[model samples]
Target: MFGKRNGLFFDGKITLEQGDPEFIELFSRFAYDEVVNEPGAQHPDLDDATRSMAILATLIGCQGVDAYEMMLPVALETGVTPVQVKEVVYQA
Candidate 1:
């Protein structure tokens, strides 16, 4: 399904040596294609930066270090400022 290397998040940089290929494939499809590609609502009230900050706060509260690591880049990419990210972590 990953026709292009750029379409895959980690792409050729990381290897999923420990997990079952079937499970990985399924999760990748669901997470990237289904969840990320779908925007069920048009929440003009919450912009991308705000959503990123909320996600950061939730990640901090949940102690989701790995997920935070992964999402931090996305947050920054979506225009979340470094100061705001730091503030969210500090507040959490």
Candidate 2:
């Protein structure tokens, strides 16, 4: 989280806990801790770039353009290249 925090988060919370505290809490607990950090959900063989690409594809398929735009920079920072992102979009 800290490594990807520069643009995606502010002071340990996304958008400085904007809107409602509950939203931040739920997202942090469920998305960050419970799901993303779950031991069983992680793959030692899959690098960050691969994971980010897959996530971008998922977001595109889900029609999460707003979220995709928000996360694109972070994905790049985490090692996902622009070409990979484009291919994911192309594939979708």
Candidate 3:
């Protein structure tokens, strides 16, 4: 419940509401250490800002409103500016 409200992007209670279940599950497994944690399926070694950029690109490509909104905190955490996010979208 708090995960839904603690962030500004997603309106629903679960990642399924914001993005595909497969995407969420894949990202979760890759983002953490305890899950599937496949070496070949791992996320790229990017800084937080770059990671945000990649996420923004994926969201924009998918037209994922919930995912896009939810990524704001990660973008901020990664020092990815709003302008950067927009730029990535425009470039994509």
Clashes of each: 0, 0, 2
Poorest 10 consecutive residues by lDDT, candidate 3: 1-10
lDDT, residue 56, model 3: 84
What's the lDDT for all of these models?
A: 0.80, 0.81, 0.72
Q: What TM-score would each prediction reach against the true structure?
A: 0.63, 0.69, 0.53
The TM-score leader among the candidates is 2
Ranking by TM-score: 2, 1, 3
- Candidate 1 lDDT, tens digit per residue, 1-92? 34335434345443452336777888899977887667853367978888889988998889899999999999999999899988898889
For model 2, residues 31-61, the per-residue Cα lDDT tens digits are 8788877785778898878888988999998
Quote model 1's TM-score: 0.63
Q: 1-92 in candidate 3: lDDT tens per residue? A: 24455433455544463557678777676677544355544466656688678788888889998988898777878798878877987897
Q: Best candidate per lDDT, number?
A: 2
Off by over 4 Å in 1: 1-19, 39-42
Which candidate do you rate higher for lDDT, 1 or 2? 2
Report the poorest 10 consecutive residues by lDDT, candidate 1: 1-10
